[model samples]
Target: MEKQTPTLESSSQPQLKLAYLRPGDMIDVEFASATKVRTKLQLVGFDTGRYLLLKQPNPRTEGSYADVLFEGNPVIVRLVLEGEAGECIAFKTKIRAVTNFPFRLLYLDYPEQVENRALRAQKRVRTHIPVDVTADNNQADNTKKLASGVIVDISSAGCRILFKAQNEGGNVTHMNIKVSIGSGSQKDLLMLSGQVMNQKKERGMISVGVRFTDEEAHIIEVFDHLLIDTEFEC
Candidate 1:
């Protein structure tokens, strides 16, 4: 059997009337709070009914704030964009934070969908990609300066890391995280400043959620290529 080739849609014309979002576009959302929490969300699915389905980059445990409703409404969110040609993209589905607390901001990737027309129909394509990560903890003892942790997963804006720590120290809400991407021969490293958005303590295990800073927006492209390539390869 012959391998099927994927089709590329024209990028010249804009399909959807979405604000700050285009198909295959990744963006970060910031929340208002003391911690300045943020999460990574991916635009996996969409509904023309003024809403889109955003997949949470991390998984949440039971009885967590992510399980509860936001603003007295369900955890499902809708993007209410303002300005000329305002539009609303509703996400009627529930999302789990993969963490314990709620982060104020979220990073999201919007994928475009094709609409069926008189002569052409829409089809779904898969892409595959990979991400590289490096995290460090400055709180380690003075003599032993080392950061210990492994990234659980990553999206366009942020990532979830699993670290081993016994307790929280004083004045340490942010950490230095580095991420990179590339295939066998080509690799690119990106340095980002992140803050601890949420912490979960269980015995000897600690999971932390972190979001990228405004200056780190450039890294989203590396992540997007990894995701899209990974999907296609798979």
Candidate 2:
């Protein structure tokens, strides 16, 4: 059975609206079958109002999903939107074709409509605050993967950062967030631990959503600064 989703404007709850998705966006695909197979696919390309083209998952890692990916097979597609628009978008469609000539690809019928659900609990305020993020991949090793970015929007619960990927050769998906509040002698280094919730990469820049863990007290001042800055800007 397919999951029923309400329209964006029909409910006062978190609205799910169609977002302008990019080519490399990652989306989850769930088949409406007995096994109910689910997998992740990258958006290769698409024809507006016609169909969506997705890169088929690697056969070695995903096994051969040939049977489950047949034509006319129903599938549910879900994707997350980070940044200021924090929500999840879902739609139901059927596989139209699968090709493996130049590259393996899965074609899906265009959905008539899509449903979105808000993912953020607290509202976020927009701001630009420089911060350094460090990714500790191995606890036993001393190797540190560091990247510098600015917090674009934030709340007490979570925040979004925009930055250029460092040559450190790994994604800062789950990293420790270090933010500097003041300048010079009065500078306050607020260290907050967080897990990367969602990330989007476009061009050479990346946007990531991070949820703080047990750092409400440390973020109060930062949040207050953002609130005041927002008020001043308005």
- Against the hidden true structure, what lDDT does model 1 obtain? 0.40
lDDT tens digits, residues 148-187, model 2? 7888987777778888855554565666544434334335
Tens digit per residue, CA lDDT, model 1, 140-191:
3322222455556554445565556645532234655443444453454434
RMSD of each: 17.4, 4.9
Q: What TM-score does each of the candidates earn?
A: 0.31, 0.79
Model 2 accuracy (lDDT, Cα): 0.71
